[model samples]
Target chain A: MDVVLQQLRHTYAAPGLEARTVLMIDEWQATSGAQILLRGISGSGKTTLLNILAGLLPPTTGLVRCGGQSLYALPEDERDRLRATTIGYIFQMHHLAPTLSALENVEMPLVFGRKLNAGARRARAYELLDSVGLRDFHRHRPLQLSTGQRLRVAVARALAAQPALVLADEPTAALDAESSHAVMDLLQESCRRTGATLIVASHDPALATRFDRVVDLRNGALHEAETL
Target chain B: MYELKLAWRNLANRPVQTWVTLTVVALAVALAVTVIHLNEGLQRGIIRASDPFGVLVVGAQGSSQQLVLSTLLLQGLPVGNIDGHIFEELRDDPRVALAVPMAMGDNIGGARIVGTDEHFFDLRSSQQAAPAFQLAEGRIFAADFEAVLGSRAAVGLGLRIGDQFRPAHGVEPGLEGDEHAEVHTVVGILQPSGTPFDNAVLTTVNSVIAMHAEALAAPDASTTTDHAAGNDHAAADLVSAAETVSAAETVSAAETVSAAETVSAAETVSAAETVSAAETVSAAEAAHADDHAGDDSHAHASAGQVTAVLVAPVGFIEANQLWRDFYTGAEAQAVFPGRELGGLFDLLNQGQEILILVGYLAAVMAALTLFLAIYSATESRQHLLAILRGVGARRRTVMLVVLVETVLVAMLGALVGRLLGYGAAAAIAGEISRRSAIPVAIGWLPQVEPALWLLPLALGVLAGLLPAWQAYRVNVVEKLFPS
Candidate 1:
């Protein structure tokens, strides 16, 4: 699946200030199985662009097309179904259900899709957890696992549905250097094995150097950087 | 199915809050159901016990309530006696199916001694009904001085067939020499009728008259002394003297004086003529004694008085006529126990409605508790619910999960509460029976009560609404980002 954006623009309304444009992109595209890094400072619209591409937020004025279908042209529920089967999002905070075990948290995305029974869901969740090298920690909850281990579980969950696109917003932001590198490696390796297009939003230049492509968001415009 | 599992997991996550809410609901349901059961049971038991006696007529000399209580309930002071001829008139009437005459004044071991005849055993409330009295052992009294004990009377007094006991002059159990010198033997024991009759000792009307006659003939000194005070020697001396004169002679003398006073004043006779009349009564008494060997009706000389008459009319029309006839007469007052019971229940209905109102208020409080618990839980789980939405759960699914949790708790509370209600009802019924000797069975199942099943469910749905709506509208972006 290929992602396309055509003059995408988004705005936010404040109580007293005039409406402010948060994001503006002119003609940016990425093909399937491509690992792209989005680098930007705070308020640079790095997360906003990722949200638009995932169909989680519609652009205020412009078009977003993932695969061949226009993402914003569909109904809200249809977009949700599309996201469930086609896109997996990893948040900065991991956001694992505190009460669920590691294996159950990884099984969450599969519960929303069809063609998986209880046994099959468990089996697929186990396979994903093994891929992340957290198979022995399946019974541990999010609070019991280290930050790196928690992010690894999140990566496993993001790939559980075998989505075409994997979106990560600062997934390794709270991890130490060694743990951050290890998490990044696991995420990249999982995406490669599944042939999923990976887009990670972060400010870390050291992490950006490992991706196939890196784009910088500055002053509401996209800038292409040299690939590693 | 997954939504239900999630709801269960969420509830299980907070054990204390969940259990406290469940206990509140269960207590409310139990109280409401117990009130309903007890009210229904008391009404039913009273109606069953009151249905067997069609009407009662007592002497017009005293309170009607007292008469009905004494004659039908075997509980109050005996009203003054009416003419025994009233019993004959009711028995001979074509509209009257059966009439049992009662003469109640004495007691044996705290149990009422009811003076009635053999027809009393065969009497029924209506023409189509069967006899109410059935013997549990032995036979009905066939001769004067013989007694038949009711179920409770036999149990309470611990008397069996061939057991002899004397009656006290009044209704109280212990009055020393107030007990008549002549002893009456128990002949039979009646089955439990669940009526006032269950606590009465039955004998021929003659036995009542003979006992009173003996009590009146004895000197006043011995009558005041307590029989339990070791006065056996004095009581023996008096019994020997009374036996020498015979109970028939004493009863006959009392009746002759009563008879002579009824004669016209213009036909007044001399003292010598009274003595001659007394001699003639003595001869008649000897012949009556000889005839008593074969006859079961003893002491017929005292057939002039009775305490009350239990009249069974053919139907409502006959009953009304009897009521009017006796009401107008100067001798006795007639009453319908069913009508009186209806009036009593009418007075009770107001209290019952207030009780039910309180029950409903408690149910409302339970609903409030449920609403608060769910609302608070939703507030704490906003992030978790937002994550669920982010994972592709629809708004409808989130709302359904909350609703299902509320309903499950309500269902569990109702189920357990119904059992507790039944247990409470049984306990109350047992207490009622123990105190009043009136058997009250626990009423029908709680499921039979619509309020018991539907109130909790309706409240659960109503209480779940706000929280469910809140869950439905949770914003995944705001909760996830918060920036």
Candidate 2:
């Protein structure tokens, strides 16, 4: 379940502009079940690196191997499937589909997986919602939930597929200090319980001490911070 | 299945838009359906009403359409009568299979009392096998002054077996006060024949000839109050009565006193009211064939005179020969009821085409409305689509959900519209049966009704195509990440 990145670099091209490189990293590694922090200044491509690892964006010249499979080497649909089964995502603003309930948002990945019947999917979603302390609010829509509660639901949804790696891009940026700490505790606890690698991308320096490793994405390079 | 569920949930989320879209679609389908069914029913109703008199009509040469409309359809006013020799010629013609005489211009209430014999019931021609008249209650008319009521006529007038009603002199409204001394007794009530005959009161031509002769012998004995003044319009009442004096009463002119010509001499043939060349005949021995259904004309007491002769020749050759003879003859003109009806529908079909054109336009508008409504729903929910894509739902599934949503709404609306269209058409047919003698029965229109449902479904699919594509090509990262 370990994730390996080798010589990954990404660039953006628009008409009449030089190709601008967004992310470049020689190599990075995470053991299965390890928690890590990625810190950088604004516009340093911390989110871009996480997107590549999540198989959402292919790197310009590198290999992303999650759970021993090269992600970008496969077709887009297969890559999507691999992402569905092997990597989970937590966006910055708790982008839960408003059409689905809190519990249904957690169950969405499994629905796309097509591997479980309705009864089994419901049971799994119930267990996860209970684990995230959203059992009573399982039936409530995302709009009806508090900000912290919404992020907690997102944490439950990210772990629903039992992925090998979970990527969080500024997931707690909009929360209060206490709520941010609580959201982080829920995400770390959930990832630890599932033995999945956790990668948090944020500009906040205070989150540096809470992971097994800390990497700084600065000027398209990865530097290991001293403390982690 | 999951995609359909998601689509339905999305549609349900926008209740107002969904209902408005469905309502527009239903109304559009209903309008199209009504036009289709109405056209179908009216055409069939006209055929039903025309089936009994599928014959060549012999009448005085004027408006042939007016003759058929009055005699066969029991509507309008008869063109003047023809010589009884013409009726005898048709009856003796070897090619003619059926020939029944008609005399008109008398009424019991607003219902016309037609003078025809039992042979009128044996009608069948090129159109279809007309069900012969059978008694539902009593027997056919036997002696003069005995009447046979049509099925609907009996029902409408609330008459039964042996019920006697006095005859009025004419079909005009005030003529009920111009009652004749004869009290006609109803001897029979006919079965429902699904024709205009079902609304008429039928009797013997001999009886009509006898009654008119008695009126001619009495004072103020002009026919239709027209011979003296030639002014028997529907509203001619007291003035006509005050001026009722034909040459038969004033000049004691020959039985061929030229009633239709008023006081003028050396006039058109009907001026003598189609009185044959029977040189010697006394009153009460009048032509055995006149119908004074409105009592609008009185016959000269000749041996041969009839308003119209229903002649069902053996086949096309005989019918053509007979029509040619009458067309060339000076006394009367001949008419084919089916051809007259065909021309009527040809005119009516033009108006129907316009209505159908409007229906097509409504359908297009309904389809466009479906397109715009579905497009907006998908447009506003692009974020949700992006989220689903982000969560590993395939683009195809997202597209299918949108397509399924639009079609589901359209199909539901169409189902309801089909019901309403048929209901409206059946109601219209019922009205025709009530107001006129046309017996219209509307069942499922197998020929064109399926298109009503299928048209909307195809439009639903077509309308959904663009919106589904929009949902498919929704930019995932732009919507999800906003970076």
Please compute DockQ, using alpha carbons, for every candidate against the native two-chain complex.
Answer: 0.43, 0.51
True contacts kept of 1: 0.34
Candidate 2's C-alpha runs over 4 A off are: A11-22, A40-44, A59-61, A102-104, A130-139, A170-194, A202-210, A226-228, B60-69, B75-80, B104-112, B124-130, B164-184, B205-305, B315-317
Candidate 1, clashing residue pairs? Answer: B176-B227
Per-candidate count of clashing residue pairs (backbone under 3 Å)? 1, 18
Q: Residue-wise lDDT of candidate 2 within A1-228, one digit each (tens)?
A: 788889988998879999999778788888888888999988888878887887777788988888788888878777667556667898777789897899899998888877688999889999989987899999899999998888888888888888878999897788888888888888898788888889999887778878768888888999988884
Tens digits of per-residue lDDT, candidate 1, A75-177, equal: 8777777666788988888889887889988988788765489999999999989988899999998999988888989888888888889999998788888
Quote the B-chain TM-score, candidate 1: 0.74
CA displacement after TM-score superposition, residue A41 of candidate 1 (Å): 3.7
Off by over 4 Å in 1: A16-20, A42-44, A53-55, A99-107, A114-119, A122-153, A174-186, A203-206, B54-83, B102-117, B123-130, B142-187, B192-308, B445-448
Give the per-residue lDDT of model 1 (tens digit) for B14-54.
Answer: 99998888888888888877877877777676666655665
lDDT of 1 at B467: 96
